[model samples]
Target: MKKIAIFENQYHQVKIQFEVANKIFFNDMLEYHQFNSSQDYTPISNISEFNLVIIDISLSSNSDKDGFDLIEEILIQNNPPKILILTGNSNIKENLKKRNLPDLPILMKPIDPIDIKDNLSKLLV
Candidate 1:
């Protein structure tokens, strides 16, 4: 099974919804790991263990880094996993541009299960 890691701090409901939807649709093929902050995820020595990573732009104050920082760290790996951005921030495009990151797939806030599934399908392909 492929693994997916999620880094989300503020949107528990959205995360729960995605988990349910994933279980219903891709349970046999995908496994999900959720982290509430950078602190929770930073301990993992192998970021490439996951097939994909979903990140929320805004993180809790307790986190040592934000989503962008996490993305940069992941991208520097020899075999970086695919990334999907989930955010409410309107300036996400500008942020990516400012950081010189690629135009990754993005899911805006207030998304439904269908939206998540669609993006997952694309990323997992």
Candidate 2:
């Protein structure tokens, strides 16, 4: 079973992505995503246990750079899962450049399963 983590801020967006993932996946998968810190969407024992993490790089919480903060936190960990960023903002590439982080794989919003599938294939491969 592929363990996938989706770090997203919005409820409806997570629902949409989950639906898309479900279409391509079966019940054996263990999926997770970030929601309000108060609520646990999918209980994870360890962050590093995931096979892949799909992050939405939108402004969330109190920080304008919350997405980057999350990425940095994950990258700091030992053997972090494969990471992907999803964003509607085009300036995100420039933002990554300013921070000196590599241009990580990204998928724009209004995404189809094929787009997600393609990138996942490349990133996981």
Candidate 3:
């Protein structure tokens, strides 16, 4: 089974949507690990355990780091998991360019459940 990690401050909302999408499109085959803040994903040792990571560019105000920082960290791993960015920020492209990060798949906020499943299908390929 493929594994996924979701990092989003709006945990419940994102979880519920993904759960529905998984059930309908993936037949509950995917395993999910969720984090509400950067700290929740700390130690970073387990980053390679997942097949994909879906991260929100903006996290809780209390976190010392944002998703971009997390992505940079992940990229340094020997074989990083695929990443799919989630953001409400309209300047996502600019922010990514500013950080000199590689092009990554992104899904804007208020994403439709079907879109979520579609992206997942593509990424998990």
Candidate 4:
């Protein structure tokens, strides 16, 4: 079983992500956690416990950095978990491209349930 950490500020988005994953994964098969702030993300800095960490670009209170700061924090870990960046906006697509974060996968939001299931299944396998 793999552990998953969902880092997002919005309740609806977090719920949506959880529902998508739950539909595909049984409860006993996975471990999950969530954080709504950079402050909240402190306890779970070590990525070894999670196989994947999903981050939402738009945070409710922390809207200044466009989530790049969270990305940077995750990168500081000794063995960072695989990252999946979720965003509804395409404006930052080029910006992220410039950064060249090869290990991260950017998933556009209004996320498709099928895409999440399929990609996660692939990761677990």
Number of the candidate with higher lDDT, 1 or 3: 3
TM-score of 4: 0.78
Best by lDDT: 3
Candidate 4 colliding pairs, count: 0
Candidate 1 clash pair list? none
Worst 10 residues of 3 by lDDT: 37-46
Per-model TM-score on C-alpha atoms: 0.90, 0.77, 0.94, 0.78
Mind giving the per-residue lDDT tens digits that candidate 1 earns over 6-73? 89886566867786667777874678788888879764458889999999988788878889988888
lDDT of 1: 0.85
Model 3: per-residue lDDT, tens digit, 4-34? 9988888786777888888989999999998
The alpha-carbon root-mean-square deviation between model 1 and the true structure, to one decimal in Å, is: 1.6
Tens digit per residue, CA lDDT, model 4, 31-75: 667777656655545666788887787765764444767777778
The per-model lDDT (C-alpha) reads 0.85, 0.68, 0.88, 0.69
- Candidates sorted by TM-score, descending order? 3, 1, 4, 2
Ranking by lDDT: 3, 1, 4, 2
Model 4 regions lying over 4 Å from their true place: 14-17, 25-28, 43-45, 63-66
In candidate 1 the C-alpha lDDT for residue 1 amounts to: 83
- Winner on lDDT between 2 and 3 is 3
